[model samples]
Target: MVADNLKRLKDEIAETASRFNRNPDEINLLAVTKLADVDMIRRAYDSGHRDFGENYVQKIIPKMKILPADINWHFIGHIQKNKINKIIGKFALIHSVDSQHIAEAMEFRASNNDIVQDILIEVDSSGEIQKNGIPIDESNELVHFITENCPHLNLLGLMTVAPFTDDRKVIASCFEKVRNLRDGLEIDGLKLPHLSMGMTNDWKIAIE
Candidate 1:
């Protein structure tokens, strides 16, 4: 069931990319394994899936011990200051960095380990107070801060979540804002090559 689901999801992603004239190869499908069972993960792995996302260090560590060594683990959850040590040299990418404090803590940990941590700045373009992200207005400052001060941190791009509503227009508006934000942010010769937006709910709109 997991293998079939993964294949179907990949196919849909490819079709969406084609609709936007985007190369499907450039679009990475990160299987978020927060609720996935070990057997389910194995099924996807057997199907040639390597990249996986986890919401917490405690959960990912145990899974890492049992999983193959080459799996690229992406930490896509809210990062805590104290948990920085657990994630520093482990995850291939951290997708929810929003504050200077978090970035600074990550930088310290990465510098100590002599490793550069790749990350995406989470932006709250949805204006939802309940969400965890740097506000869209303050995102530029956060991006600049990471690029200038945090040498051990690689600011890859921006990530945002669209509001949880069935309105396609609203979701597309949120995604467009983030894309435009990413474009405008490359001012000081900074190139943000990725935009990590989309999820189970509104991923198709995100591709468009």
Candidate 2:
């Protein structure tokens, strides 16, 4: 069942990518394994899936210890400053960097380890009170701060979480806003290459 589900998701992702004239390979299929156990993750790995995202540092650490070293782990959760040491050298990508304080702590940790850390700036495009992301207006300053002060941190791109709504238009608009924000940053000489938007609920609309 896991293998079937993985194949179906990949197939759907490919079909969605085609609709936008995008190469499906360019769209990374990041399996959210936050709720899955070691056995489930191993099953996904055995099925040829490599990139997996986990929401908590504590949960991901144990999985990383047992999982094949080739699997790329992405930290896609809200980062707490106290846990920076736990996540810095472990995950291949950190996707929820929402503030300068977190970024600086990550930089310090990465520098100490002599590794360059790749991360995405999380933006609150939906303007939700519950979300953890830098406001869209303050994102530029955060980008500048990372680029200027954090030598060990590589700002890969922007990430946003759209409000879970039945309205497809709202979802599309949120994704578009993040994409446009990325483009605007590029225009200003910040080379952001990835836009980590969308999730299980509205990924198809994200591809569109």
Candidate 3:
């Protein structure tokens, strides 16, 4: 089942990327293994999907212990400062990095552990009050601070969750804004190369 899903997902991703003249490899497929069991995740691994996203530490740790070390883990949910210690040497990317406090905790943990973790700055592009990310206006300042304070944390990219809407234009505009932000920051030597905005629901539109 997992292998079939992976193959289908890969085909869908390839088609979407092609529509935008993008290399299929340019778009990454992170298997969101939040509620999936170890067997399911390992099945995904067997099918050549190396990247996995987990939301909770409790669910992820046991799976991590069972899975191979080569698997790339991405934390895609709200991360607490108190939870930082447990995840210090575990994850490869923390996607919900919103505040300075969490940033500091990650910095201290990564620095002390001698682990250089890659991170994506989560931006609240849609102004969702319930979301956990820095506002678009303060993104630059937060990025600057991360660069200065966390030498062990590499700011690999930025991520945003677009609100669910029937309008395709709104979705396109959101992704365009993220792309523009990345480009604008690059002019100032901030080379943020990754933009993780799309999900299973509208990933087709996102690739375009």
Candidate 4:
């Protein structure tokens, strides 16, 4: 069942990216494995799905231990300060970096661990107060802070979560906001190549 769903999802992602004239390889379909047991996750893995997103630190720690070492585990949850030390060198990429303080903490942890942590600055582009992200207005400052001061943190791109709405225009606006923010933030020596947005409800619109 999971494999079938995974194939359909990948096909849809490919189709959508192709429609936008985007190389489907440029769009990674991160299998959100939250609430999934190791066996369930392994089923997706066995089906050739490797990149996975998890919302909690505790849940992913053990799974990482048992899973294939090459699996790209993404930290897609709101990060807590207390666990900054816990995930220093663990994740392949972090998509929920919501503030300057959090980025600083991650930098400290990464420097101490002797590893550079790659992350995306999460922006509240949709203006959803209940969601976790840096407000779009102040995201540029956070991006600059990481680039100028945090030697251990690699600011690869930006991330945002669009509200779960049937209105395709609204979802597309949120994704566009984040992409524009990323473009505006880039300078001569820096380039943010990734934009992590969209989910099951609005994935098609996101790629388009």
Candidate 5:
């Protein structure tokens, strides 16, 4: 069942990419593997899903060992400074880089290992106080600051989780905003290529 689901998701993404005149390969799928078992993850890998996202450290490490070296692991959860060492070389991308303190800690840790880590800045697109991210007004400055200060960490792009709204127009508007921000920053010689937005429910709107 997991394999079938993965395959269907891949096909759907491919089709959606085609609709946008994008190459299917350009749309990388990061399977959200939180709470999933090794067998399920293996099934996803076997089905050609190379990127896997995990929200929990403990649940992710075991699967990391079992999966093939080619598989890309992405950390999508809030990271503790003490636990920074454990995930240094493990993730291909870290999508939850929200603060200067965490960014500095990750930078210092990566420098010791001589490994450059790719990361995306997460913003509170929903505008909720409970979420952890740089404010929308301050996001660009934060990105610029990280690029200048954190030599070990590469700022790949911006990522946001929009509020849950059933309206398709609202969802599309949110994703457009992310794209616009990325585009505007790119104009200033900042090469932020990835705009990580959308989820299972509103990915179609995101793609549009």
Candidate 6:
């Protein structure tokens, strides 16, 4: 059943990408395995899914231990300062880095481990008070700080979470805002190559 679901999701992604004249190959399907158990994740891996996103540190650690070494783990949750040590070297990409302090902590830990940690700057594009991301206005400064001082940290791109809503216009606007922010930063000379936005609810809009 999981394999079938995976195939259907990929098919949908391909169909959606085609609608936008996009190469399906360019769209990476990160299996969000935050809720799935280790056995379930292994089954997904067996089905050829390589990238997985987990929401918590404690949960992802054991799975990383038991799973195949080649699986690409993405840390997609709010990162607490105290737990930075546990996740620094383990994840392939940390997708929720929002503050300078967190970036510094990641740099320190990755430097100690002799690894360059790749991360995305999460932006609170929706302006929600509760979201875990840097405000859009302050993102550039954070990016510059990471590039200039944090040698062990690689600022790959920006990420944003849109509000879960049925309003298509609202969702599209949120994705566009983040994409534009990324583009604007590039104009200023930062070479950010990834834009990790969207989710199960509105990924098609993100692709467009």
Better of 5 and 6 by TM-score: 6
Task: List per-prediction Cα lDDT, in the order shown.
Answer: 0.91, 0.92, 0.86, 0.88, 0.84, 0.91
lDDT of 6 by residue, 1-208 (tens): 8889999999999999999999999889989887899889988999999999989889889878878999999999999999999999889999999999988888889999999998999999889898889998898899899989999998889889999899999989988988899999899898988889779889999999
Separately for all candidates shown, the number of backbone clashes (residues 3 or more apart, or on different chains) is 0, 0, 0, 0, 0, 0
For residues 1-208, what per-residue lDDT tens digits would candidate 5 score against the true structure? 8888888887898898888887877677778988677888888788767888988888888777767989889988888888889888789999988888889999999999999999999987657787777777888888888999999999999888877879887777767777888898999999998888878898877777
Off by over 4 Å in 2: none
lDDT by residue for model 1 over 31-141, one digit each (tens)?
A: 999998788888899999999999989987988999899999999899889898999889999999989999999999999999999999999988998999999999989
Candidate 1 differs from the real structure by a C-alpha RMSD in angstroms, to one decimal, of 1.0
Instruction: Quote the lDDT for 133 in model 3.
Output: 80
- Per-model TM-score on C-alpha atoms: 0.97, 0.98, 0.96, 0.96, 0.93, 0.97
Q: Candidate 5, which segments miss by more than 4 Å at Cα?
A: none
By TM-score, the best candidate is: 2
Indicate the worst ten consecutive residues by lDDT in candidate 5: 124-133
Q: What's the lDDT of the predicted structure labeled candidate 6?
A: 0.91
The digit string of per-residue lDDT tens for model 4 on 1-208 reads 9999999888888988888899999899988888798999999999998899988998899889999998999999999999888777899999989888898889888988889889988899878779899998998788889899999999899888999888888888989888877777674456999899888788777788
Query: How would you order the candidates by lDDT, starting with the best?
Result: 2, 1, 6, 4, 3, 5
Residue 85 CA displacement from its true place in model 4, Å:
1.3
**Which tens-of-lDDT digit does each residue in 1-208 have in candidate 2?**
8889999999999998998999998899899987899999999999999999999988888889888999999999999999999999798999999999999899999999999999999999989999889999899999999999999999999999999899999999989999999999899988898989889899998888
Clashing pairs in 2: none
Q: Which ten residues in a row have the lowest lDDT in candidate 1?
A: 181-190
Residue 208, model 5, lDDT: 72
